[model samples]
Target: MTSKNLLTALLPLVSDLSRELPERERYRRLLEAMRALLPCDAAALLRLDGEWLVPLAVDGLSDDTLGRRFKVSEHPRFEVLLRSPEPTRFASDSALPDPYDGLIEGFHHHLEVHDCLGCPLFIDERPWGLLTLDALDPLRFDSIELDALQAFASLAAATVNVADRIERLALRAEDEHQRAEVYRQASGQQSKELIGQSKPHKRLVEEINLVGGSDLTVLITGQTGVGKELVAQAIHAASPRAHKPMISLNCAALPDALVESELFGHVRGAFTGALSDRRGKFELADGGTLFLDEVGELSLTVQAKLLRVLQSGQLQRLGSDQEHQVDVRLIAATNRDLAEEVRSGRYRADFYHRLSVYPLQVPPLRERGKDVLLLSGYFLEQNRSHMGLGSLRLSADAQAALLAYDWPGNVRELEHLIGRSALKALGQHRERPRILTLSAADLDLPSPSTAQENPASQLQTASSVAVAVGDLRQATDRYQRQIIEACLTRHQQNWAGAARELGLDRANLSRLARRLGLK
Candidate 1:
């Protein structure tokens, strides 16, 4: 087939990949199409499988090379890219020290790769895999061809990422659906406590569910807004003690002296403010969970009392000094480095060890990979429904911006942004637009470091970034994008707030955003 015909044939197939193609078939078709587009001798496609690069498809290579596994550890070329962001360039002779120092071994050494390109396949900044192509002759790839192939490599990366995500989602969706169905049957009694369908999140749910039925203590560790409290609630709901109420206390929110009285109960006249006898969280949760958030903030006095309760399942009430026994599960959460705190003598070593019987660390939002988009969609949908809005999707520009932003507050931040966006849209008009858009300005973020360094440099560079296309609509879209970007910086990524303050509906603003990437 002619190259034009090859491109034409792929138009429909590439348009809708709703029907999943097998990895083998996908790679086979990809390589066959690639061979038609840009023929290079001995092209090898390395699919990232965790740490190892499993070869997916290759042409013009020996049978022996096809048989063996390309362990990432064995290949020096992959090691540097795995650790850093810089792309590796290869030729038969170069002044700089090449990363492919020891990769070519035995019969494969005969394939003298004069020109090569290696770019890291990234899902969310982290290296998912490496794409490497080779030419038998000297100096083959130019800037244009390099750009084209890398674009193709990116398409492959997106395809693979989507494939893996769908596979994981299938399993997670089934598990969550089953749990959700069970929860409904039980009238929310059998709660799907673990809400996320992400891999790490699912794994955390599984681990917590297994340990929840038992009497083991759990230490939940993660950055702020990663949902440690929710995990604790999930654990409590899954246990045999699900019928009983679960109580919670933030160790960081209490005063040093009051923390003890608040936790162990206080009789009348325990202190100046003790006008009535109060049952502490421990007593209230006698037959269930008492989640202690920010547990690392406990004073030494409170720590001593906490340690004693964990050790003997007993507590002494203040004022009356009455000894009380309670049947309760304790779940503690902290973002602080407890191990270091123990080394510094701030936290009791025994308490630290005891709390960590089943340690569940929540991975950050960025680490969750493609789930960022998935969760964003979920939040947007939830927000729209809450506002009585019809089905709405994220504009392409808004979607890209959402992915690019560093979610410092993790899921909570994203959730808030989506909710706020919906509210902003609802207030603007009674009717909901088909697409909700948030440009860079809508994000309400600070100036990027590049812009901060040199305003003039950014201004000059921005105009030159996007290449000119044939259509006037495309050109208009490009100009609108730059203007929107400028507006975002002017207002600082606050979409709904910015839009309201500027007077516009969330949807109309987003359609303008969709046009931004048309070219």
Candidate 2:
């Protein structure tokens, strides 16, 4: 390429700063332009993230290469590149192993690249990341133009800096808008207060109070419908950022494709149906709390990105190269056991460690003892007001029933039961009763013997049934069902406990139970 062509090529990259090009696309176009100027088989743009080099854009690498983290201490090549501001090229047969050994596209045989060149991208004399080019042919880049490479690296730094500034500005504006909205409805709040005087309940409240004041990431674990969200709300309400809005995103509610875009805002036309740029939940929760419900449902890919943001306080919007800074205290809740998920390879171990800086376990309603009645009264009153009734109360028998049965669905089930019983009692009244009374019949409480079966007895019953079965499959199925049933009973229907005893994670156990029609 002639000097005139190289200068002309540089103009487009400089012009890209003014245009609304997505960060990733701009980096890609820049790499492509550089590759065009200096011929190479593969090229990549990696960003410096703490002690790791995260690939931001790549033209000739495997898809998995983007997901992999390249640690500086482990990879001498990356460490060497980071040490110098000038361009560095290694001898084709250098003893040090290459980081991109089998990662380069169409070069899957694990054969070493013959030539390699890397230019450290610097912004304001500070090391940012690097641009790397590789070739299979030994003499491909033997006489590479170092001057042109350095010049292009300067332009790449500008591209990164420009992208970062633009994203931060736009996100700041969005954050301000959300903050304004949060302040307007300061008094209009949900039922975040925990309402129980039981020892377990009091201890949980104490835990919340202890952890709520700091910006530490919290992991709330419990069974399904155990009011994890309410705990998160209470924590946020008590935190320093309480005055700001608490943004929430349900990882289980989102599809895989939309998860990234929903957490990290996306640029216009980033994907199909993305008509305009949109701010993500993280950006909205910049100054406040972000409650990620059912966080265990997030894919590994999303988990990696989430961990990056938590560690660096930075995230690039989908399709846009600009990096946005956010200040958020995350409270993630999940019924599934994350430790088990990590062991099962469904969740990222590093992400799990990052999220569990302070763990809070929400006690189940069954363990809360009389707290069930307390929550029942709260929900009963709530339903009463909503139903336009003057007053409502649980009858003596209904109260006894509420206390007697183990609440399998936790507080949520009790709340629904009270509301339903209230309606039933009202329907049976001949006239408008000032005080609607819910009876044991109205509560529809199960028998104690049936609801609270002994695990040993349950296991024995299963063994008996299994022995009576004629077919091998039926007997095996019956035996497996019995073991699971006994484990669930032993643990008082806590899936986490049952999972631990059965050598399965809550997710896998739940799936198995569903297949067996246990639910």
Tens digit of lDDT per residue, candidate 2, span 320-430?
Answer: 999999999999999999999999999899999999999999887766666676577557656755666544555555666776676779988877887777887788888
**TM-score between candidate 1 and the true structure:** 0.50
What TM-score would every model get versus the actual structure? 0.50, 0.53
User: Could you tell me which residue pairs clash in candidate 1?
Assistant: 441-488, 441-493, 442-493, 442-495, 443-493, 444-492, 444-493, 444-494
Cα lDDT of model 1 overall? 0.64
Q: What does candidate 1's lDDT look like per residue over 1-519, in tens digits?
A: 244654664554475356577655666666666555555555566656445565555555432233224446545666665665545665557433332221232222333236666667777765677666556555666532554555566666776676666755754443444434443444443232333444556678778768876778999998898888988877776676666677899989988888888799899997898999999999988987789999999977788778899899888888886789998898999999999999999988988998999888887775554456667655654554455433334544455566555577987898898777666655666565433444445555443434222457755654455344556555556655665675565445745433442346767777766656522
What lDDT score is found at residue 356 in candidate 1? Answer: 90
What stretches of model 2 exceed 4 Å from their correct place?
1-187, 447-519
Global lDDT scores for all candidate models: 0.64, 0.78
With candidate 2 superimposed using the best TM-score fit, by how many Å does residue 487's alpha carbon deviate from the native? Answer: 14
Which stretches of model 1 miss by more than 4 angstroms?
1-193, 425-441, 444-519
The positional error of residue 4 in candidate 2, measured at the CA in angstroms, is 99
The clash number for model 1 is 8
